[model samples]
Target chain A: MDKLLVSKRMKGRLVQNAILQAIFFFATVLGLIALMLLLSHVVMQAIGWLDGDFLNNFPSRRPEEAGMKSGLIGSLWLMMIVAPVSFILGVGTAIYLEEYALKNRFTAFIQTNISNLTGVPSIVFGLLGLTIFVRELGLGRSVLAAGLTMSLLVFPVIVVAAQEAIRAVPQQLREASYAMGATKWQTICRVVLPAALPGMLTGAILALSRAVGETAPLVVLGIPTFIAYLPSGVLDTFTVMPLQIYNWTGRPQEEFQHVAAAGIVVLLGFLIMMNSVAVLIRNKFQKRF
Target chain B: MGIPTNQEQPFSVREMIVENQRRQHWPKRMEKIAPKLLFTLAALSVLVTLGILFTLLFETIEFFRRVSIVEFVTSKEWLPWNEEHGSFGVAPLVTGTLLTTGIAMLFAVPIGLASAIYLSEYASERTRRIIKPALEVLAGIPTIVYGFFALTIVTPLLQNVIPDLEIFNALSPGLVMGIMIIPMIASLSEDAMSAVPNSIREGALALGATKLEVALKVVLPAAASGVIASVILGISRAVGETMIVAVAGGSSPEFTFDVTKSIQTLTAYIVQVTTGDAGYGTTIYYSIYAVGMTLFLFTLVMNVLAQYISRRFREEY
Candidate 1:
C-alpha cells in the first residue's frame, strides 16, 4: 500500500512538471507568433505599394503618388547631426567615467542620473526638445533641433555601451602601457581605445538605429509630416520615415494604410541594415577574453 | 654598441627640436583640457535632467496659475480644447492611464515570465539562440508599427469576438503595448534567472525535485527582486508609451472602466494638443506641460522604486 501511494504521487508530480513546461513553451511560441504575424501582415499590405515611385515622389493626398522622398533625405540629414554629436559626447562621457573619475559621491550621482535618464520616457524628452530646442533655442522644429533631441534621447545608451566596452579591456593591457612609461592619455589612446573601438561602434550603431525609428520625440518637436521638399540644411524643417509612416497610418483612407506599411518596410529595412552592421562589427572584432 | 654615426641619425637637430616642442605643446594642452572636456560632456547629462525638470516645472506652474489645483486633481473631466467651458480635471486621464497600464501588465507579466523561465531553465543552447534573437527582433520593431497593428488589425479582430468593442478602444492598444514591452521583461528576467547560481539548482534536483519545481521554487525566489524590477520597469514603459496609445487609443477622455469604450491617456492628450494648433501660452498649450508633468512623475516613481528594489534585495554570490 505504501509503495502504491508513493508511485501515484510521483506520477502526479511528473504530470505537473510536464504541464508547466508545456505552458512555458507555449508562452515563448506566442511571442514568435506575434512577430511573424506582424511581419506577414505588413508585408502583405506592402505588396504592390513598395516601389521606386514610392521612394521618389513626395507625399500627396493621392496614395499612389505619395512617396517618402523628403522624409528619406531628411532622415539622412538628421543622422548627419546625430551620429557625430552622440558619438563624441557619449564616448567622451564614458571615457571620463571609466578611465578618469574616481569612485565617489559625484561619480555615483552621475551613474544614477544616467540610469534614471534611460528610464525617462522618450515623450518627456520630446517635451524637453519642444521647450529648450524648438522654443527657447529658436530651432523651430528644424532637423538640427530634432537631431539634438534624439542625441539626448540615445545619449545614455551609447554611454552605457561604451562604459561596458571600456570595462572589458583587460587591466593587464593598461598596465603594460604604463610600464612602458606611457602617460594616462597615452595609455588610453594607444591601448584601451583600440580594444574598445569595435564594441563602442556596435553600441553606437544600435543606438543610432533606435534614433532612426524614434517618432515620439520628433512628434513632440512638432515635426511636420507634410514637408514636400527635402531639407537642404540642418536648420531646415524636416520629417523622418517613422513620422511619415505615422502620418500615413493615421489617415482615414484604407489605401493610406498600405502606404504606411510600405513606409514601415523601408524604415525596417534601414533598421535591419544598421543592426546587421552592428552585428557584423561585433562578430568581426569579438575578442575571446 | 658602436659609436652613433651622423648618417644613421633619423632626424636633424632642428627637426628633433621642432618635433619635441610640438609634442610637448600639444600633449600638455590636451592632457590639461581633455578631462575637463570629457567632464563637460558628462555634465551634459545632468543638464538634460535639469532641463527636463525646469521645463516641466515652469510650464506646469504656468498652467496651475490659470487652473485651480483642486479642480485639476479632483475633477473627472479632461476637455481642454474648448476655450470657454473646457474642463481640466485630470482624473479621467489618470484613470485611463491606469486602466491601460493595468491591462498591459496583466497581458505582459505572465507571457514574459514564462518565456524567461523557459529560456533560462528549459531551452537548449541552439533553441535559446534562435528564440532569443526572435524576441530581440520583436523588441527592435518600432512602436509605430505596433500602433498601426493595434489600430488596423487587433481592433478589428477583437471587435469580431466581443461585438461591442469600439474601433479605437483601450483594449487593443493596451494589449499591443503589452506586446511591445514583453521583450524588456523577458530579457531582464532571463538575465536574473540565469544569474541564479548552479548550486541551488543542483541541490534542488538532488532532492528529487522536478525541473519545474526547481525553476519555480528555487530559481524564481532567488531572483525575485530582479524579476520584480523588470516588471516595474515594464510598467514604467507602458505608462510612458505615447505612440501606441496616441494612434490606437481613441481621443475621448471618459471616466469609465469599460475596456470596450474609447478613452484618452495623458500621452495621447499631449499628442493631440501638439498636433493641433494650441498656440503659444494658451491654456491648451500650457496644459500639455501639466499633463507631461503627470506622465513624468508616474514614470519617475516606478523607476525609482524599481531601482530601489533591485539594489536593496540584490543577492550576491
Candidate 2:
C-alpha cells in the first residue's frame, strides 16, 4: 500500500510539471501570434488605400483626394538635415571619449550621463527643441529646429554604437599606424576609422531609423497638422509619416483611419529598409575582417 | 658597437628644428583645444538636462502664480477649458495612468516571464535564434503603429468577446501596451536568466527535479533582482508612452474603476491640449509643463532606481 501511494504521488508530480512546461511553451507562441495579427490587420487595411496618388499628392479635406506628398517631402527634408548633423556630432563625441579623453571621474560621469540621456522621454527633447531652437534661437518650427531636436533624441544611440565600433578595432592596428609614424589624427582618420566605418555606419543607420518614426517630439514642436504644401528648404515647416498618421487617426472620419493604416505600412517599409542596410553592412564587414 | 655617421641621419638638424618649431607655434593651440572641444561636446547633455528643468520649472512657476498649488493638486475635476473658472483636478489623469499601466503589467509579467524561461531553458538552439530576433524586431516597431493596432485590431477582438467595451476604452491601449512591452520584459529577463550559471540548473536537475521546477524554484530566485529591474524599466516606458495612449486612448479624464470606460492619461492629456486648442501663456498651456514635470520626475526616479538595482545588487554566477 505504501509503495503504491509513493508511485501515485510521483506520477502526479510528473503530470503537473508537464502541464507547467506546456503553459510556458504556449506563452512564447503567443508573441508570434501577436506579430502576425498586427501585420495582417495593417497590411490588409492598407492595400486598398496605397497607390501612386496616395504617395504623390498633398493632404486634402477630402479623404479620396488626400495624399502624403507634404509629409514624404518634409520627412526627406528633415532627414537630409538630421542625418549629417547627428552623425558628425555623435561620432566625434564618441571618438574623443574613446580615444582622446583622459580616463578619470569626469569622463566616467560623462559616459553615465550619455546613457541616462537616452532614457529621457523623446517628448522632453521636443520641449528642449521648442525652448532652445524654436524660441531662444528664433528658428521657429522649421525643419532646422525639428532636425536639431531629432539629432539630440538619437544622439546617445549613435554615440554608443560608434564607441563600440571604435573599441572593436584590434590593438595591433593602432600600434601599426603608430609604428609607421602616423600622427594621432592621421592614425585615427586613416587606420582606426576605416576599420570602424562599417560598425559606425551600421550604428548611424539604426539611429536614423529611430529618428524616422518619431512623432511625439515633432508634435510637441508644434508641427502644423494640415500642411498641404511641401517644405522646400530647411527653414520651411514640415511633417513626417508618423505625424501624418497621427493626424489621420485623430480625425473623426472612418475613411481617414484606413488612410492612417496605409501611412503605417509606408513607415514600416522605411524602417525595414534602413535596418536591412545596417544588417548588410554588418554582415559584409564581419566576413572581411 | 659602431656609432651612426652624420650621413646616416634621417634629416639635417636645421630642417628638423624648423618643422618642430612651426608645429609647436601653431598646431600646439589646436592640439591643446581638441581635448577640451570634445569635453564640451560631452558636456552638452548636462546642458540639455538643465534646459529641460529650467523650461519646465519656468512655465510651471507661472502656472502656480495664477492658480494655487492646493487647487492644482487637490481639485476633483480637470476642466481647464471652462469659460469662467476651470478646475484643475489630477485624480482622473492619475487614475487613468495607473489603470492602463496596471492592466499592462498584468499581461506583461506572466507571458514575459514564461517566454524568458522557455527561451533560456526549454528551447533548442535553432528555435532560440529564430524567435529571439523576431521578438527584437517587435521592439523596433514604432509606438504610433502599436496605437493604431490597438485601435483597429485589438479593440475589435476584445469587443467581440465583451460586446460592451467603449470605442476608446482604456482596456485596448493597456492591453496593446502589454503586447508592445513584452519584448522588453522578455529580452531583459532572458539576459538575467541566461546569466544564471549552468551549474545551478545542473544541480537542480540532478536532484530529481523537473525542468519546470528547476526554472521556477531555483533559477527564478537567483535572478529575481534582475527580473524586477526589467519590470520597473518596462513600467517606466509604459508610463512615459505618449503616441500609444494619445492616439488610441479617449480624451475623457474620469476617475473610475471601470476598464471599459474611456479615460485619458497624463501623456494623452498633454498631447490633446498642445496639439491644437491651447495657446501660449494660457492656463491650459502652462498646465502641460506642470504635468510634463511630473512625468519627467516619475520616469527619472524609476529609471535611476532600475539602474541602481541592476548595478548595485546584481549577483554574478
Quote the positional error of residue B62 for candidate 2 in Å: 1.4
RMSD of 2: 3.5
Interface RMSD (Å), every candidate: 0.8, 1.8
Output the number of the TM-score-best candidate: 1
Clashes of 1: 0
lDDT of 1 by residue, A176-266 (tens): 9999987789888888999999999998998898899988998889999988988878888989899999999999999999999999999
Per-candidate TM vs. native?
0.97, 0.93
Judge the docking of candidate 1 as incorrect, acceptable, medium or high. high
DockQ list for all candidates: 0.85, 0.59
TM for chain B in all models?
Answer: 0.94, 0.92
Model 2 spans with C-alpha error above 4 angstroms: A1-11, A287-289, B1-12, B16-30
Consecutive 10-residue window with the lowest summed lDDT within model 1 chain A: A29-38
Instruction: Report the C-alpha displacement of residue A11, candidate 2, in angstroms.
Output: 4.4
lDDT of 2: 0.86
For model 2 the local lDDT of residue B284 reads 88
